[model samples]
Target: MKIEQIYTGCLAQGAYYIVSENEAAIIDPLREVKPYLDRLEKDNVTLKYIFETHFHADFVSGHLDLSKKTNAPIVYGPTAQPEFEAIIAEDNQIFEIGNIKIKVLHTPGHTMESTTYLLIDENGVETAIFTGDTLFLGDVGRPDLAQKAGSVTQEDLAGILYESLHNKIMPLDDSITVYPAHGAGSACGKNMQKETVDILGNQKRTNYALNQPDKESFIREVLDGLTAPPKYFGMNVAMNKGGYDSLDTVMDRGLNPISVEDFESFAEETGALILDTRGPADFHKGFIPNAINIGLKGDFAPWVGNLIVDVKHPLLLVADEGTEEEVITRLSRVGFDNVLGYLKGGFEAWKNSTKEIDEIKRISPAEFAEAFNENSKVIDVRKIGEYSAEHIDNAYSRPLDTISDWVSTIDDSEHFFLHCAGGYRSMIAASILNSHGIRNFTEVEGGFNGIKKTEKFPVSDFVCQSKTL
Candidate 1:
């Protein structure tokens, strides 16, 4: 028997491939299914089932497409009322894949249909548990995301999660390996460990949620630091529940190369968003006026999901030549399937054609330190937690994620300097601000990290009492 954890770093997600004899199963697949198909072909195994822990909210799952291609049944736990055809397995139901057996443990807390699949080896020894969102290495899944209108509250879900862990998970063998869906960078769980796989015994000892003395404490602790989830979460969930466009079709539409003239005309006609997927440094040099920069090198998909919010928004890409397919694939992973096309010949074509170009004013950290004053307007675009921990003495705490809410509050007459931890997020913020016609700010070259290295400005470690300037 072979078990492979296919980990995608960008999403911080893990999809499992388990093979025993000539049969295999896939658990929690990403939107792109070709890789899995190729793996099955190379291994010469027949895909017996496509297993989903729950209807995911972060990225659209490839269960529908994978099932369609392989004729494999998509399996979920009880109470999962998906619009598409699936097998709603009962609690403790046993499924055989050649020499091994999979036992379904209905652990519903992250969502009503959340489940953990227990793999029993050919020798009948309970080996590993794929705990989808229900349990992470260092933390449990946040209970607030699954709340419905006037129905199950977050507290109630937390209590259910506590029961699920103690009843179905904690009672299992300490030596059993635990494989979760997400890791530290994911928005699914706040306190997930960086390690993707851990022994159940280690989690019981170190995971805060698993050690809670009572249900009340577990609920309060789990719900404590959770901010609002990304706005595109619900849209992805809807697509995962219902069906979505085939990834093949999405790629065909997005890979088209549009001429500069046609690109501008399409933007005007459809109001499509121009997304520039280049590094922050290169993007700062020059870009098409009003294009938003969310670099493909960083946490591109999550940032796009958070800032853009609308998964169906038509997008015209301005990617580094040869990376258009990658950008489109990443966009489609998060359910952004309405890509119009990419800028033909990359951004150079637009510049060569004498199209109006815009540039962001960036100053070195030394320059910023030389110009620092108590009265100078500054914006810290890091997370509130990071800003509160340590920031410039008088900088306003306007996080990049919440820019759409506080952007209008920026005074046009006053100039501001913007910075993030290492400049990537601030550049993104700068581009969005420019797109909105609020371009009175100059970005710090290396953001707060560079500012700290200068040792010229006063850094405040005081906990922020207020968010205002």
Candidate 2:
């Protein structure tokens, strides 16, 4: 079998392509199907089947488009109970594509429709299994999504997931390799491996959930550890059922260079919030006063949600020359569509205009500890749920998304020392606070772990966050 791992940098999603004999099957395809079609043509093969392990919750799937374009049979579990059309597959169902033997295993932990496909090469030896979100490398898929389209609870699904893992997924051959749909940056599951490839033996020994003493303990631990699925998940499910409306092509739009005088005039008239997408090193050197510095090097969208800006408000991007299209794409992924335009010529244009630039105060962990001990009010800007699980000493929790509502809770009488998991979310949090007429805000240099050694005391006791886990 010819297997290729396809990673979509646009959405940070991944999929698999399996080919045997003269036929090819795609598992968990993205919105754009042309690339898959071209692959088939290039390899001198015909597209036969497209499989969606489950209705995806992140980006839209290309299953429908692949079916529409190729008229190939689309397969999903009979109990998928999806909103769209498909040929319902049953457990233990076997089919031959070229010389490849495909076996469908009904594993309903992540979603009712969730499945894992076992493949045997023409040599009759088991090779790899496509295990969707049902089983990840170190962590299993979060079974906390609402089940049966809208009727089931996360606990209900999690219970079934327990049965599925112990009874079905765990029984596979130790040599069978595993391929999951998403990786590290995916919200689908926390603690995802950096690489998608994992052998069953390796996963069996190292996967925490897999190491539980017994079934009951396994159920409790797996279900209790999940973070809340993102808000956009439901829409993505329906999108896959109906088929994703993928971009035919990414259009590169250019922004003309603007002088500082022009930028100032535009900012005053349009009131577009300036978005900086450069790295921390570049941003800390100099920036437009009051501009938010949530760089695009990391997951920029989720943090966009944490931004206190009103979604109804407009935004102007300060991305470098090649990143204009990317900034727009990532923002749209997170449901932010209010982008006005980009700052032409980037920082160089501003410098050429001779406008004064300001540097945001970035501090090391040691300095942050001394300041935090003496006079600073530590603000953890992660979600309320994350803050509850683990947090720093003397840190007051104001979730990134809802901070504007609780600004008054802070005395504004102390030095504001802020941090998030990494620096990205903190940068975003700092930018939000700065925009809200609050000054004296300093973003922690390394975020939580970067300055972790500076702790004057032990990490604070935590509570079970309500909404997430």
Candidate 3:
């Protein structure tokens, strides 16, 4: 028997592959299904089933396409009412895959249909548990996400999760391995450990949620400090519940190359968003006049999901050479299927064509410190938590995540210098400000990390009361 955890770093998500006696099963696959298909073909194994822990809200799952291709039925736990055909397994039901067995544990906390799959070997010894969003290494899934869809309060979900963990999962043997859907950097759970796999016994002792003595305390602890989920979460859930466009179709539409003339014309005709997925430094040097820069290196998909807001918004791409397909695949992972195409010949084509180009004014940290010492306004575009921890003195906090709401509040006449924890987020902020026609600003190169190294500016560690200048 072989069990493999296919971890995707960008999404902080894990998909599992299990093989027993030439029969295999997949759990929680990403949008792209070709890799899974290739693996099965290479191993000469027949896919028996595709298991989903829940209807995910973060990324669109590949269950539909995988099932269609392999003739494998998609399986979920009780109370899951997907629009498509699926087998809703009963709690504790046993499924046979060649020499092994998988037991369904109806753990409905992250969502009404959330379930964990327990793998039992040929000898009937319980082994690993695939605890989707129900349990992370260091934290439990947030209960607030399913309130609207399940028609239950977050408190109600939290209580159910408590019962699910205690009654269904915690009672299992300590030797069992725990494989979760997501790790750290995922919005699914707060305080998740960076490690994807852990022993169940270790989680019981170390995870804060698992140690909670009562349901009430668990609910309060889980719900505290949950910032609002990204706006595209509900849209992703809807697409997952109901079916969505095939990955082939999304890629075919997005990977088409368009000349600079057609790119501009398409933008003017359709008003599609021009997303530049280059590095932060390259983006700051020169880009299309209104292109939004969410670099491919940083948290690209989540940032796109947060800032774009609409899943079906027609988008045109300006990517580095040979990376157009990668950009499209990543976009499709987040349910952004309406991508029009990419700029043919890359951004250099536009520059060569004598097209109107815009550039962001980037200054060194020393230059920024010198400017700030004079009569310059500074805005630190880091999160409130980071701002409160330590920030440059007199610099106001305006996070890049909330840029849409507060972009209008910035005075058009005043010049503001922007910086984030690193240079990536500052470029994103600068692009957003440029799109809003507020271009009278200079971005600090290397952001606060570089700024703190220069002792010319005063850095305050105390929490500040006001965030706005």
Candidate 4:
């Protein structure tokens, strides 16, 4: 059996393409299915199955599109409550395509209908187990996500997770390799190691969740340090429920070619979101009021998704005319097809037009130090684990994933200052606060590293906060 792990760093997701002899199956599909299909076609393998580890909450999956395009069945665990059409895959249920033997294992930890796939070679030799979210290289999936959505309590799901870990995953051969749907930077797991893969024996010996003193203890530890999943998670889940219509390519968004006067009219009437995709520094220097600052430096799709897109408004992007196609393609990959059009020239055109703009201030380390002591409060938007491990003393912290809640914890009357590991989340978070009329704010340029390098921190060095910044 041959397997390929496709990693999407933007979402920190890992999907699989498993092939043996002449047939293949793809697992935990991203919204775009053509990439997987292209692989199968290029490899001369017939596509046979599309498997979803579970009804994902983080991003939309392409299971429906794959099934529709290839005439392959969408496979889910027997207990899955999927709204769309899918085969109810039962535990130990076996199917074959060419020489590949597919065995389904109903692992109900991450979600009620979570399923893992085990593959056998042409000679009937068991090869590996695709554990999905049930097991990861160093950690296990958080029990909280699917439970609340499915009307299952965390305690109930934790019980299921314990059983899945001990009874199903643990029983696999020591040599059986394990594959998971999520990796580092994903909210699904608390401490996923930075490894591409792992063996059953290795996980059993080293994975903290797997080595718990007892099932109860494991569940407690697993949920304790979790950063809340993104606010868009549930929205994505509902979207993938009925299944999504996939894109062929970047949709040919017609350039309506509005006159400059008409562009301003639409900006006033239709409420087009003008995204200044320049540098954060440039945006902070000057840009449009209500124009969100999503610099091209970070992962474009997710930042755009988190900051801009919704089921609500259409977007008017402003990129260097050179990056127009690049912007469209990235946004399309995330299912944000609401691109009305792009600004003709760039911010320079806007500046020339006397279009109104706003500026976000990037505070210096000394300025931040003064703010840290006197001017304003600091907000750390790093992950929960990262914050708890070590952080700027007495600063308000909630990971970027939990920004919605982060604000709720603080009184809006008091100004909230924002910072992240680097400058990414700080810009995003500050943009959020700035929109809410919290204007007396700024991000410590380069975040903690910037603050550290520019001035001696008032505290000690615990973990490597990166002078490499």
Maximum-lDDT candidate: 1
Tens-digit lDDT track of model 2 for 117-142? 89988988888889889988888888
- What's the TM-score of every candidate structure? 0.98, 0.78, 0.97, 0.86
User: What lDDT score is found at residue 383 in candidate 4?
Assistant: 62
The TM-score obtained by model 3 is 0.97
lDDT score, candidate 3, position 420: 95
- Residue-level error in angstroms, candidate 3, position 393: 1.8
| Clash count list over all predictions | 0, 0, 0, 4
RMSD of each: 1.1, 5.0, 1.4, 4.6
lDDT of 4 by residue, 246-276 (tens): 5543345523334445566777687777666
Q: lDDT tens string, model 1, 328-379?
A: 9999889999998999999989989968889999999999988888788888
Q: Could you tell which candidate, 1 or 2, scores higher by lDDT?
A: 1
Ranking by lDDT: 1, 3, 2, 4
lDDT of model 1 at position 344: 94
The CA lDDT at 322 in model 1 is 96
Give every collision pair in model 2.
none
What local distance difference test score does each model get?
0.93, 0.74, 0.92, 0.73
Report the C-alpha displacement of residue 171, candidate 2, in angstroms.
2.9
Q: Lowest-scoring 10 consecutive residues by lDDT in candidate 1? A: 460-469
Cα TM-score of candidate 1:
0.98
lDDT of 3 at 335: 94
The order of the candidates by TM-score, greatest first, is 1, 3, 4, 2
